[model samples]
Target: MRADIHIDSDLLQQCRKGSSKAFRELVEQLKRPAYYHALSLTGHSDDAMDVSQEAFARAWQNMSSYNPSQPFYPWYYTILRRVALNHLRSRSRRREDIDNGQIDTMLTEAGGPGEDCQSVQYSNLVQQALMHLSIEDREILCLKDMHDHSYRELADIVGVPIGTVMSRLYAARQRFRQLMKESGYEHE
Candidate 1:
């Protein structure tokens, strides 16, 4: 096992014993990546934050089920992904149309730098294109690129084989590139 995995196991052991410091360390380590994964899956910051929080709560409640011999991220991310997917499915009434207006509102509320006109335009374009993608594709891309998971790790999180992970990642990247090219954002 990797050194980090060993350290994670130690943390998990402490957490299982109800050590608050260990729980804080575990949450601090996993939170940002989990949030990013949720955001990429849900495409809404508010939903992602809520999902991440819920996932952590669930994880803490189910800490006994966590296998210390395995990696922690896949187990943690599985919870976040499920929560986000559930949230998406519950709103299936509004599935067909890509809500650009809501996405714009979300991006604005995220409160990043939009003062530079070019940056704002670029951010808007990226947001629109991301919204155009199916949630599944976005989730795959986010797990692979944004979360920097290995194919095996992604497969474990998404409950697929490594071959499927590779194929889907390839296809999703190609599609994202195609969308960027179609939007005239590709450089020569």
Candidate 2:
């Protein structure tokens, strides 16, 4: 599920007023979703944790710039996305090599071909295709598809217009479908 929280303006005001407790509450509400989002971007649990924490640290340091009128998570997501992209750039590598052994293990762990096997296989195929996609494509897909962010939320988090979000998400999905086809997996 999307990592959503009702961050009331009073909480933001308290945080802006140097209330450590309030900021901690904010962190507590967001940390899990932030980490999982980071994981989808970074593909490594440790890097995901580090990226999410660093983003939070940056967000806290720049709290004064936050506008109370705007929703908090989208703003926070902007920070997190930048940190994750920066992390990806610095690493200069992508984990695109999910070998057969790993895939076999993953499939085996799901048990023999049952009623849900096709769904499991499709899910794995999509995930594997995502790993091979550009960060931009993966980010857009993950935010829109996986996290269920609306176009407005995506536009805010991506610093783009709503039309741009629509276009980007469409293009990303096209690429994803092509990748899945190339991988010999097709779903209607």
Candidate 3:
């Protein structure tokens, strides 16, 4: 997820001076994207909530290191990504409870799974197909498609050149299309 708004310089200065209100404001602007971004990586609501909060705590602790001249999210994203990756690493050791029911709810909402069983089945297949993607692929698709980020924002958040972002997006979509085909989801 990307925020088009730049961080207020005054807010940064105040935060640097230990102003709690300024810090809270900054968190308010970011916390939703941060949580959704973490959710994209972690694939579990609980893990996303925990890791996102932890990343914010770390961001506050390391506030002095931030360059006020730069866009805040790219730097903040580094911290969030590190924390999320570490969580993924540790959690890989354990059996993750795949919450398919929760996923069904999400798909139903997005696909508007109505009276039609076919659409529900399609949504489920799409959800399962997403699980087969690499975390990077899934993250890019969600950040760009679901979160409505521009290519420039995508480049910044993903830390890649615009061309690479374009190429990766193409490849990810192509792979997803293949998955859908293989899963028997015909185009409407």
Candidate 4:
């Protein structure tokens, strides 16, 4: 784990000791990441803003429940995911289109200037396929593939064993591939 990625243990201890500055500093450090994660998971800008803020509030209100010795994000993630998923469950009956026409950016460099129409179309198809995935699958894919988090980091943030992260990633990718095939995207 990078020393910079986690807020210092001492900082967490200070928060535990009821240091308001430490708490604010912790929230400042985490706010953007938590918001982005919520945004990706919820696929709705407003919901992301709401859920992430709520997660922070809940986490702060229950700070005593957090263990100071461990990495903060993992504990925070539990709160964030619960809130985000609950939001999803409430909206499950009304399915919104997942940003149609947003191209899969991974294809950008791969396609290059020389690769034109077909590549662009393929990228769109892949993105559409991605949109069809379950929120948990999408979150796992984002953490592992998009953000390039290693298995251990994924395990920490996801509150899963490293082995489970690997297995889940494999399953998510497999389902992604299936979706692509269903969407008329043939792997090149």
Candidate 5:
């Protein structure tokens, strides 16, 4: 998620200087978003956890490459995305796990309390539709829509130009809308 939390420059400097304590603090701050973002890409809790942890390890190993002035998540996201994508690639197939139970839990968390049956069903449909999308399409959609990343953040996180981010988000939205319609979910 695009949390407004900023990594303290001091903390980052210490991390760069090989302080495991500082890096642990960084992990405490970012671990939730890291897992959730990885989950969005990997579609399984176990895989997401593994991928995010691996990304964090990689981030620590490559600490010198990080620009302390920039937001940590975006930089960390690059590692997380790479790790997640590699995991996805190694799996050799997109599993149908999203439809099973995780999507329901995610929807419940996103929806908060008092969601009706209709809302749950709609969320299920949306998740199902998302599963049908290409990984690129799904990643862009989740990064923008689910995680609240801005266009510039999207470009930075996805390693694309702002124009490419806009175009991809637009195209991904169109395809998602079509998928929703096919799943019998109509929206204005």
Candidate 6:
């Protein structure tokens, strides 16, 4: 097996033995990937953080059920993705009932200028484009590009066939390129 997979197996074994330190190490190793995956799905930092944390908590609780031979990140990410989707659903419901006062409050809270305005602007634009994508499209992009997972790994993680992963990835890239072109970005 690959070095990363070997390390992951070891960490998972440690976690299954109820070692808090091992669990912490696992979290440290997985957190950034999990957070990025969540962000790619939710298009919001707060939601990503919440989803990532919830995923880890659930993983900790269910550590005993983890199969050491399996890849850990995919298992963890599946949980994070589910949490993010649930959060999006809840947000959609709340949005229907949002009042003018709440809207104004949110705007005010978000109005502060940041130091790296250009980076923030770019990030926001990318996030907006991602938000326009279908969930499957967003997930394909996140798993293949952001997380550097292989198509086979993605298929396993998403419970889909490899052909489906390839098709979704192709469609997602085409849509993302279209979105970028529409937004005045030069698409290759």
Best by TM-score: 5
Mind giving the per-residue lDDT tens digits that candidate 1 earns over 74-162?
Answer: 77777877888898898673645544544454345445654678667766776777777788787787666655677777787788899
Q: Write the per-residue lDDT of candidate 2 for residues 135-168, one digit (tens) a residue.
A: 7898888788777888877887788999999999
What is the Cα-based lDDT of residue 49 in candidate 2? 89
Full candidate order by lDDT, most accurate first: 5, 2, 3, 4, 1, 6
The runs of at least 3 residues in candidate 1 whose Cα sits more than 4 Å from the true structure, single-residue gaps closed, are 1-7, 93-119, 181-187
**TM-score, every prediction:** 0.77, 0.85, 0.86, 0.82, 0.89, 0.75
Select the stronger candidate by TM-score from 3 and 4: 3
Positional deviation of residue 111's Cα in model 5 after best superposition, in angstroms:
4.6
Q: Against the true structure, candidate 4 has what lDDT?
A: 0.78
How many angstroms is residue 165 displaced in model 2 relative to the true structure, after the best TM-score fit? 0.5
Pairs that collide, model 3: none
List model 3 lDDT by residue over 27-126, tens digit each: 9988888877787777677888899999989988989998888888888888988999999888773333555444343345455425588777776787
Q: Which stretches of candidate 4 lie over 4 Å from their true place?
A: 1-4, 96-98, 101-123
Local accuracy by lDDT, each model:
0.73, 0.80, 0.79, 0.78, 0.83, 0.71
TM-score of 3: 0.86
Q: Model 6, 64: alpha-carbon shift in Å?
A: 1.8
Candidate 5: lDDT of 116? 84
Clashing pairs in 1: none
lDDT of 4 by residue, 1-188 (tens): 12134788888888888888998999888877777677667766677889999998898888899987688888998899999999888776444555544324333545566778876877777667666788879889877776677899889999899999999999999999999888777777
Model 1's alpha-carbon lDDT is 0.73
Error of 2 at 145 (Å): 0.9
